[model samples]
Target: MISSKEIKRKPDQDASKHYDSVIDKVLQKLDTVCKEVIDRTNQNNQQENEEARFGQQVKQKPMNEERKEKEENALLLQLAEKDKGRLHLFIKLVDYMTVETLVSINQTSMSMLLEEMKKERKNGLFNTAVNFDVQIFTPDEKEISEHLKCLLDDMIVVMRNTARVISHQSMIGYIKNTKLGELLSEQKENKDCIADVQGIITDSIEYQNIKNEIFEKVTSDFQAAEVYVNTNYMRCKPIYEFLNTWNQGDFENKEHTLDIIKSHVMELKKWLADINFYIKDIAKGILNVDGKKIKNKLQPQVVTKLENFKDYLYKLMQKKANQTLTTLQTYTSNLSKNPQNLKEYAEFIEAIQEAEQNIKGLETAKIEVEAMHSLLKSKFDLNPLKNSDIVMMDDIQAEYLRLTLKIKEAEELCKERKQEMMKKHEAEFIKFITNIQNTTSSVNKGKLILEETQPADALQQLNEIKTRSLDRFKELDKNYQHYAKLMGLSVTTNKDLQELEATYNDRRMLWTHSDKFNKLYEDLQKNIFTTLNVEEIEKEMKSYEIGILKLRQNINNLSKEGRDKVLDQHANRVGNVSQFMPVIQALGNKDLRPRHWKKIFEDLGSAWQPGKTFTLQELIADGVMNKKDKIEEISAKASGEASIEAQIEDIKSKWSQLSFIVNHYREAKDKFIIGSLDDIIAALDDHQLKVQTKLGTRFVAEIRPSC
Candidate 1:
């Protein structure tokens, strides 16, 4: 181990010592130069201060004094020119020393020392150049001062360039040490390692500051180096942002995520391509590599990874787009099958809207993917996905159009159907109105008939009208309700139908009371002779009277003018019954024999016989008297010779009829020829006529001749 290795190690140690000694000497000379510059600047400042203190007391100087001042400034410029070369050499040495020192130091220490050097240089030399006092110095002095400042600025630029080179080399060394290039080369497998490298490059404050310094020092001297550092830094910054901002879950099969991935990939490709172009010249100068080689190392691999990731995203997008298309197709197909009703139509419309939204999303997705494709082709020269891979909005729009056409056709059909239904309903309504009007007319006609007809006949006619009207009204009301509901109209109330129903109800009530009274009167007539229950008959008559009163009240309650007509008819019927009620009571007596009844009926001029049906009209038509009046006349005759006189008159009337028949037979016998058939028929005809003439003399003479 001590043989050849020790000999080689000794030379490297000596070289290191020599380099360190050289850097120290350069730094010492730079310090001396800086001190001389600081003293000269202080002297100039003092001279300026003294001139300003006396400038108000002596505003204008003489031409000779000004020439003298100029000569003095020229001499000072000549002296500064003599020291300018040394100052330039010292600044060069200082710049070289600064680069070597930065190169020799660790990255952390170099970064800290560089920051301090930048601050000191800016505060001292840069400020001195920027704030140069032209008023205090002569023209030659100002020219000399400008030349010195330019030399110092050049030295500072070289120092800054050296610092940038060292920083770039350090960054490149760090990249190499971390195997960042290898990680980038195998980004798919070493994704986490690349991510970590990106994190270091982006998140490290020291690295960021160095990168900023390189960018700030963008001059012709190190423009390539700045671009190189910036390119590497930019390359990692986006990757860092992307990697840190997103995760595997963010790449879901959704439009928003797909769009985000597409945008990021496109931006990365564009940024990476721009960075490659920016550093093309410097690639060989500073980094000692070809621009294309660097690009091929970084861009192609990164592009490949992006292409793969984009491919994954595209596949997801395709899958999602296909699903959306399938959903849209299904909705369109279902919508094409026409909806039957409002509810189904509404559901179809909602589905169509959702389909439209999905179509919009698909279109957006397609645009995003196509944009990514365009970026990749123009910038990265990648063609992983074809245009056919994208979902077409035309197909979706066509489906939507078909859906709309179907909807339009369905709407037209519904409109036609509605119009047809409305026509049919209108016809039906007209028929209903006509039927109601006819029913009302029939009721009016019945009302007219009620005026002239008997109570019983009026009741019958009213009942018929009520039945017909009720049937018609029920049908009309049912139809009205059904049609109204179908048309979405309120069917709860109809003034015409309600009024008609009320009229029918009122007439029914009037007839009902009339029917009750008629029934009571019939009972009185049926029970009058069937039983000797006079008190029951009187009770029935009282009930009949009460029924007539109620009927009259009901008639008065009627809104129609027929009330008085019905009332008058009912009153006439009741008056006819009352006029013959006493006769009915007298005929109901069970103590009377059939002969007495026959005699009484004969005297009353009635055709009614015993065991036959009796009625009040029959007795009224026969001019019958009251039972009380007949009894009073009989009692007064019984107390006098009225009964004997009535029997003598009866004997006289029979003796007279016997004498006349004997006289007529004797006359017929005297005129007759025995056994002659013609004479016998003639004689019979003569006797019949003579007897009829004698019987007709007791009856009232007819005012009108018989037909």
Candidate 2:
């Protein structure tokens, strides 16, 4: 501190040394911290590797176990499926064997009897209760012996295979316990019986020995087989129970194992039940003591005869059942076509009752015949022909209800027919009025008591109208002759007036179609209220108009004169004209009766006016002086002698009367068309076709009964 430069040097040296020491201390602390970080990183990596190895081991063990379990489940399912299939095939084979045994029996006599029955039915001589005894039936000894040997061999093969199948290797370990031992023991007994039967069948050389020994052995073997089947059937229950429980339990995370096994179990149970029933039936059939005793007592030929008789009984039952079904079907078909008839349905019911009584106790010991028996039962129980006594009663009651419905329907149909007849009568009445109006009749009547009258009464009124109308036509002839006589003139008044009117009206009509008249008419129309010299046209027009008017007046006056003359004559003939006046008036409007006549008159009248236009060709075609010619003709006729005119009028009146009567008759005969109901007539034709169709169907359905 005394010397300033020395002190400064000393302090700088100390500071430098102190700074070196601080840097070394900091370096040591950094090394220690880095070393500790490296140790922790190493430790963490080692721990992770160990954890990964342990997790892999854990995962692999479970995966292996799961895979193994899946394989085991698949194997078990496969074996169960195979066993179930085998069992189904075995049952079918057994059934085939049993049927074969029955078929091996002699069937010639039975077949002949059935043929005879068919012939009787075809010839219409078959009676439902007819009976015939057939020759005895028996199996061919040689053929049956051979068949038995083969059958026994097949049965032994099946039993041996079944034993192997139920062993531990095939049964999915289910029979790994005493179950297999039990099955083996029962199988041994069945094998012994089959072997014994086969030995007896093979040793017998003669037909008689073979028949006796083979049948006895067959019976004993069948009994043993049935006993074995029953034992197995009982065993199946336990087996199925175990299988069902096992199928429902989960194993190794496999899917649908329970479902798969349950299906197999169900199939197996059904098979066992069927087999058990079959076995029981077989045992009963084999244990037919009466049959055996009969065979034992009888000679071989007699035994064969008894067998044929049994076969006939079986066939009779079968055919009767078939025939009953066919008969019921026929009755049903008949009922369908003629549902109103109760007889067909009643017969069907009675037939069902007959079948029930006839086939009550009929049965066959043969398995093949049982198949036919099942078919027969199905025919009676199935659709369309299905009926029991109770069902028949129910149907009968239902049919009675249908009859009640039919009664209502019949009443409705009666009312419809009545209404239809009334409609027809009313229509005829209208037509009668139309005919009367069309004729020169004195009286026209169309008013019908349609609602108030019955069909019969209405038809009577229609007939009366027709008859009266026709009678009036006959009266017209007398009136015409009397009027002609009363005229006492050379010309026929009514006839000449009719001719003159027609000619004048026709000429007037021609002017409208005349070019000269049309041009003059146009000019007159144009010159009206003007200074045009249309006098010539006006003069022509005036002449035509005055001529037409004068002609019409003459015609009207002649018509009135003729009518008055007729009335006066009628009064002379009848003593009074007043009573005939009403009849005359009714006939008076004959010209006005036609619906188109009024329109025709109006058109003609309107067209004959002044200033009407026309075409040139129409005038030449109509004849320009037609009215003048007709007037000259009329004058000429008027100039004739009165006697000649009277003669002509008499002939003309007679001709008119003949024409009117002919037309009236023609109109009356065709009333069916105009009077009948359109719908009812159409329905009648359709109903005929439907009846033909029904008859055709009946003929076709009759074939089944013959069959």
Candidate 3:
């Protein structure tokens, strides 16, 4: 039922509404996406800012930690290196004891074999007798058995002592050879490593395992050795006694007596040889011999051989003692004759320690040898040697005492020499310091004078100070070098010298510039006016200008206040001289009249006074000359003279007109009679008179009659 136009409009309107709805939905989607993007960007920016603030600290923390860890590790490694010898010994002992190829015996037997294998191994009497085949037949089996059992017990005791010593040594060696061992030993000295070492010990399974293995092996071997020796010692005594008494029946035979003599001789040789070995060990700081026990076990032939050996040892000790004393004397002589620095003194001290140790060793050897001498005498009633006196410990001790006294004297002398040298050095240093102080004081005084006094006086005083300071500094420098050389040092660039030189150079530069500035100032003062010699003032001014340029070049070297003061003074001088420039230039001008001279004097104001012979020079030097205001007044007056003359004429003409009017009025009144009083009465009624001039017409006077 609708029209066609209405239908067409309805479809178009619907399409338009749909298009607007679609556009609005698309715009909402875009807004949401944009908002999300903006929020993400803001979060990213915040995160980047935080990173920028703390990034350096976060990055450097781990690096610093790593560096510290490396330093600690390096310190521990160095300490471990010092224990290398102990480590090597522990490793060797473990390898030898635990070798798989040595399966013939337990570790205890191996340890005993190791001890016997030493070239300097010692044996008991029973073993010595068996090895040497000494035959002694006695009918008493009990006596032989007892002797054999005692020897076997002695052997067991030696073996047991040996095992105990080796076990202790191995334990100490194993502990000190590891890093943990080093840390424990050096904990007091290196406290910084204590925590690290503790951590390593607590945390490191490998270190714990190593420590356990060492302890277990050493303990096991020692216990096994103790058990083996205890069990076998009694069983071995019977076998030992049987072997020892196999040749017992031959005791009365002549050949048997000869063999016994030979056996005693061989035992004496072995005993003496052992004594010789003990002497060598004592020399190397090892003292393990017991002299009294050996004395109780001696035989007759052995005592005789020992007596002879004693004489030889006495001579040998005496010779060695004399040699040691001679060496000490040589050291003392060297110490006395040479000048020793710290290093040489340290060397001498070390030599003294070594010599003292040697004397101690000889004293010990002497004790052992003297004990043997006493034993021989007591046991066998042996007579003293006919030709040789025994070298007692006292003789060596006396020489040691003399050597110490000489060293003390030498040390005192060295100390005295050092004191004397230090005194001389102190005197020189005081002299040098005093000179520096005096120079500084004088320079400061010069600076004050330059600031407060006149240029002439300041320059004179500064020159004198400069000369004296230069000479003193030269002497001080020479002596400073000498003092440094005496102290065994080089002082080519000493701090005191550098500072003094800088002060001197600064003061000297100031003096030079001050002299130049004063000269220029004086020239300006003196050449302010022309002289009788017409060109003199001009020539001086030219020279002053050149000096001004040169002074300006180095003006910055002065302090700010000083530079300003100099510039101000120069400007004042130039201004004072310029004030007279016009006067000087006009001196040759013949056109100058009295009025021109008056104008110039007026411009000078209080600077030039009457009745004073005025020269441009005198005017410039006048202290009270401060009339800058009159300069423009004088210039204007000088430039406009014709105008002044014209104004004067105009004033004179006005005065003439006033005078004529007065005279004319008086004449006219006198000529009138009483009858012509009408004009006079009119004139009297008008009491004011007017005069005309070039200015204007105005009332000049009032008229009055005497009546």
lDDT of 2 by residue, 1-707 (tens): 12323332333334335434543454345335434444445555565576567765754557688679557655655655455334423433443443333223212222343344234122221111100112111222233334444433443333222212222222222232344345545765676312232333234353234344545654553455345544533343343343335422243234333234335434544543443442221222222111232222222433343334334334543544554444444433433332122233233334333433433222221222334344334422322323452354344344434534444453344333443444443464455445544432221112221123233443455455446654553354344434223222132333432343353343223222232444654443344222334344345555545544454444334342322222222123222322322222222232222222233223334234333334322322344233334333333333332334344456455545532112234457654333335655565576567445544542224222322
lDDT of each: 0.51, 0.37, 0.44
Query: Tens-digit lDDT track for model 1 on 1-707?
Result: 12223333333344445545665565555556656764665565576577779877876889799779968865775565456435534454445455544433424443563454344221222111110122311222234334333432332232232222112222232233334434434653544222222232345476456645533432221344334545553444454344445555455544465446657676766756664654342221212222343344555555666766656755654565565456657866765655454344445545555655565665565455456556555545655555555335445445555655655564555545565555566676778777776665555455533555555676677677667776667876786676556555566665666656765665555556566668767766555454446666567667656766765665455535635566566667777767666655555554344545566666676664669656555555566654446733333333333333344456456545542112334557566333435644564576557545533542212211320
Per-model TM against the reference: 0.25, 0.11, 0.21
lDDT of 2: 0.37
Compare the candidates by lDDT and give the number of the best one.
Answer: 1
Candidate 3 residue lDDT tens string, 173-261: 44554664564456536652222322322244643453344334433433443343334322333333433453423532323222343
C-alpha-based local distance difference test score of model 3 = 0.44
> What is the full ranking by TM-score, best candidate first?
1, 3, 2
After superposition on all C-alphas, the RMSD of every candidate to the true structure, in Å, is: 42.3, 42.9, 48.4
Sort order, lDDT high to low: 1, 3, 2
Clashes of each: 0, 7, 1
Q: Please tell me which model should have the higher lDDT, number 1 or number 3.
A: 1
* Candidate number with the higher lDDT (2 or 3): 3
Off by over 4 Å in 3: 1-438, 441-452, 482-488, 493-707
